[model samples]
Target: MIELITATQLDYFDNLYIEMKGDAVERDDYIVAETKRGFEMLRVVKSNYRVPKDNIVEPDGRFVRLATDEDVKAFDKNDGMARESLSFCKEAVVEEKLDMQLVNAKYTLDRKKLIFNFTADERVDFRNLVRILANRFKTRIELRQIGVRDEAKYLGGIGPCGRAHCCSTFLGDFVPVSIQMAKNQDLSLSPTKISGACGRLMCCLNYEDEYYEDAREQMPDVGQTIDTPDGRAVVIGMNILDLVVKVKYKDDYIREYHCDELNAVGEV
Candidate 1:
């Protein structure tokens, strides 16, 4: 049977979906998969489940088999080596005086490639550094430049909400988040309030943005004049979720009324 296996590599934490023709696998089980990068050892986050072929386009890769004891030992050894390589790369960066922050290093399952992920503000010249790393590791070297958001995903942290970072947790992909989303939700425009630990607009802001956009269309904006049962009132505030608007009448007495109970007259 074709089952969906959600797995991730220790080197790269992003969850990947793989289709396997197998009975079933439990969560946290180690499995081998053939990916574009080559054979990779992946830890299952979600167990195998039957998925209709018509539902999903295709999985990221095809699963090979469950990892044997020898495979696990090799994976552990590779992880240790990658960590050591990262430390050495960091020292090399310091010595070279390169303006880049090394985030992680990893070796492919076959030890054919050593990949390094780093973050830099501007264009970096790392030809000399690459040569140094190639000589030290005695393998194919790959230097990847990543953004701050991807770096945060690599190095997980607790966000301002006191929870683990979404990117580091279950977020398989990063969606586009904009300042307009914050505005649509009537949130304060403060960067500190809206930005995530990665210093980018919070991904959660996109979660309820569609709902708020629909609510805004149904509700009148603040400072708009609307005809209420009491009289013509100026909208002072709004509860978008509840479709409730607070309005002030000619006498300056404010009252709350549902959007359905009011008629839009015009802007105040």
Candidate 2:
């Protein structure tokens, strides 16, 4: 099992895991560590999570030690520097007239690497910008282009649900959320209704999908012919939560029946 922590306090910071090396590290402990990208100083938000035995740690970055008062001071200083660097990068983007929206900036604990995140509708050539930043900051520069969903995840805000976004608060990574998940749950097909603040399909759509899938298998599809206790009927609608079906009889009489009360004779 490997332990890890988030590298920055930035609300825009995604899950940048820095693996904890020793047992001394605990939750909320500020520590210095090396990440795949570069050396980082991160606070341990989580600790002692199990990893599957079959899975090997990729590009293992080691935990150096818990942070001291001096270390905290240095971290704060680097944070201020990160903000300055972000401002610097934004100005450089304008000077170069690049088509990109800068998101956030981060600096390695050793101050040797500066990572910049941005989002663009299409591929952007920031090669000249990187050179300018490298020369200005006197460090390694990384320009990362992220998707819209990722941008929303990085910079979280109150969702339409009037709560914090799941991506920034709890989700470790994005799971595939398709339009079918919405259909399976009998949700409104309206994009605005189903799409999240990210302008992508809502992550919440996946939440009840498993139950809906199981319920769907048990319940007859709309317009399907079925033999009910009342009579042979055509399914008109469903109450997935109640495991019940609404059917229309040949006489045009409509009634609701429990799924178990009906036999799926055939499709109409």
Candidate 3:
């Protein structure tokens, strides 16, 4: 069966794979479907492989089906249905362009829908630009404003950790992330350190945030003055996973102890 994995928007993010109940084709292979996000070629593998099924991976939810080429073509024919667009503001090195990276160039198949995908630092004024594209395409047009992460998904690049970009590779939706998650994980506050190419906090930070929170609750705060092996001292640092705390006792003297040695903590 041809499954359709549509992005909530054409942000070039991963889309969900739908395994519709009572599906006619229960094949051992996965089929490809086209959404505004591009194309998804998914195949079914042995459940014993232990790879997550459906949207359990992240940003879950997509519509699966047995789609025919005719179905895709007809949807594309609706000019305004599937196309997204972006209008150029000021003249650039290329041409008057909107804030979009051209993933595909040239119009084919009678210009089904003119979809504009762009990222803007501030609210843009592009009424006249839209008018220009509408007249040029002679069909319906759509403009999609995406975040920095979406652009990374559209362009496809390697991440700082030497892995494929997560937004495009597996993630579908941009789950909420906060700096607090970073703080809980003890990540650097620098934007470049924690933020992804999308200029937003990395999605990974949320993975262990709850664990950190739970761990923190079981132990004393880092700055609290607590009794330790060396002596009564103030906690200078902590390791949540190791359940260890560093206490500062005397001049330039610090000691590390597991939570098991911890005693009643005094006020900082």
Candidate 4:
């Protein structure tokens, strides 16, 4: 049977699923897994469950083993060192006068590589910064320039939705969000209302867009002249969810009618 395990780190947002052939593991158990960055300790977020091999794509990483006491110690040490490295890197950025905002840093579980994630408005020449970090840490250095969305993912916070940001909680990857999505849903064009903590269009805008788009196909646009049961009226507003349209007649009286009760005449 294929045993599926879900695991995550405190500092990172993405969950990693590991597949293995072994006894079931309990939630909160620490385990070693081979990831793209090498073997790292991850805490089990969900209990292991049996799944069909064909039901899932290849797992994110292979299970190495249950974490040993030594592994936990090493994980703790690495966490501390990674924080110190971030502090040092921030100082180096100031000293070098680099126009970049360092978000966080981490070391490979084996201490073979020190990785730094940063954000910048424009291209930043960080060759000297990398040299300085490599010399101080005495490890291979990787400086990654990430977008504003990624920065929010790394430093998580509650979104405007009054809950944790989706990208920092369960979203595996970001979907392309655009202003068109806001318009599709008939949402306010105000930036603050439609934008997320990252100052980009909220990811949730993409969730119900397909439904709105389909509904729009069956409805008349605002300002359109349509033949209502009463008479020809100018569409003034709409409640897309209920398929309701508000319109004004030649008498200047507005009335709500189901979209099904109206036929499109032409533009007002």
Candidate 5:
């Protein structure tokens, strides 16, 4: 697997999977390259971007050797230009009264293309806006409309967990999340409580789902009838994390017992 820099101090691009030959590339090697977007300078990364054998995609271009001092200077200049281009795009959006929120911008390493990212509630007519930016930058201009989740992934911030967002830091691609996952885990259905910064179900829900699912299948659920050492009882509560069930006896006494201690008679 070949690696490429996904982000820089000011710009964020999806980590690209490149196909390179021989031992010419190594981790942290800076090189000029052409990507699907345009010409770019990407550094090799240690982690691989894996793909299924059936639908593997090829790299845009081959690595063009390790970077030089001149390449470093060129990248620095491009970085500064990208920031300025973002500012310019924002002003243009305002002037045109476009229904869009500009997110970020990037300039290709060869300065032949400028890409702008934005989010909007609905489709935006950006034909005129593109012409404005094209004349200003004197290059091919692309305005990409993305979803809220993608916007969050691009401009990251602290999550509800008081740490960096998973999307920006480590998540390579987003997986499907559903509210039922929360219900299965017995979480509060409150949207504000369960949703993430992306305003979708917290991705962490998928992390331990298998464990909860297996435990639920193997154990009796709350409100189910069960036979306990004390007597016939109804399950009152549960701690899935601890693999324990709290039961209320016919005498109205409640006791927590290991899952194995209770024999399931029937579900509620």
Candidate 6:
């Protein structure tokens, strides 16, 4: 009996499945005699823009070669994973009908559970969708909906920045960011200038919001009249990052001063 599948095993099976199915290489197991080669972990997606150039799963966990018709029966008795996979496929049919795509799907070693990964433009009403899958599959079914940011991370991509996208490369989860953070940082209000490829405000904004707020506390608001060494002037703008304020004085002369110096000169 093929005890466990290795990387070579996954690779061989993947190649065979790809060749056999052409444009539709759904994941499959390969039967092979164990060797020194490693196995890779694998996940199923509706489709991938870039297919793996090599093997999938690592050889660390319990694995085996392709199951023959007779082997399948024996597997059903001993392996819960095989049993669950069949149910997952059935559930996928209905889920596919509802969404047209599934992102990441996986099953447990024991055929006790199935997980579906997906993305949508807005909230999805899968009440009927879930019931149909549950009754037909006869096992646990879970559907996880993710955002485009999460999708980009799941599939992986080069971000608008020089490095890989944060969501994909390293950010396991997203932090909240807001437009006010941009205003605090004195960033251009234009969406494109501050937003990430995800079309949301950059996650970096959250990082500096506290500092911006602290700085704003030290500085006074614009349009407030305040005294300067030269003369009194109306505050026109604030430099949040530098903690400086621009004061408009006589003859249209404008100068920025430190916040602490505002009180030293005179009252507003």
Candidate topping lDDT: 1
lDDT score of model 4? 0.78
| Per-candidate local distance difference test | 0.79, 0.77, 0.57, 0.78, 0.77, 0.58
Indicate the worst ten consecutive residues by lDDT in candidate 3: 4-13
> Which residue ranges in model 6 land beyond 4 Å of their true spot?
1-97, 105-114, 122-142, 266-268
How many collisions between residues are there in candidate 6? Answer: 19
lDDT of 4 by residue, 1-268 (tens): 1232222133222234333335446666777767666667776655645555576555566676778899878878988999999999999999999999999887767888888889999999999988998899999999989999988888889988799988777665688988998898889999989999999989999899999999999898899987877788899999998989999989899999976666443333
- Clash pairs (backbone) in predicted model 1: none
**What ranges in model 4 sit over 4 Å off?**
1-21, 25-30, 43-60, 68-70, 260-268
Model 2: per-residue lDDT, tens digit, 104-212?
8887778888898899989998889988998898989999998888888878888888999988776766889999999998889999999998899999888899999
lDDT of 1 by residue, 90-158 (tens): 999999999999999888788988989999999999999999999999999999999999888888899
Q: How well does each candidate superpose onto the true structure, as a TM-score?
A: 0.84, 0.83, 0.62, 0.80, 0.85, 0.52
Provide the lDDT at 52 for model 4: 54
Better of 2 and 6 by TM-score: 2
Models, CA RMSD each? 4.4, 4.5, 7.4, 4.9, 4.2, 13.9
Q: Write one digit per residue (lDDT tens) for candidate 6, span 1-268.
A: 1112221111223234333434342434433222222222322222233345483544233324333565445434534554455456546657556653456554433445556667776666776766766686676777778676665665665655677766654353478888888888778999889877767787777877999889887777888887877788899998788778999987899998987787676564
How many pairs of residues collide in each model? 0, 0, 17, 0, 0, 19
**2 against 4, candidate with superior lDDT:** 4
Error of 3 at 261 (Å): 3.1
Q: Candidate order by TM-score, highest to lowest?
A: 5, 1, 2, 4, 3, 6
Better of 3 and 5 by lDDT: 5
Q: Which model is ahead, 1 or 2, in terms of TM-score?
A: 1
The true-versus-predicted C-alpha distance at residue 27 of model 4, in Å, is 6.5
Tell how far residue 134 is off in model 5, in angstroms. 0.7
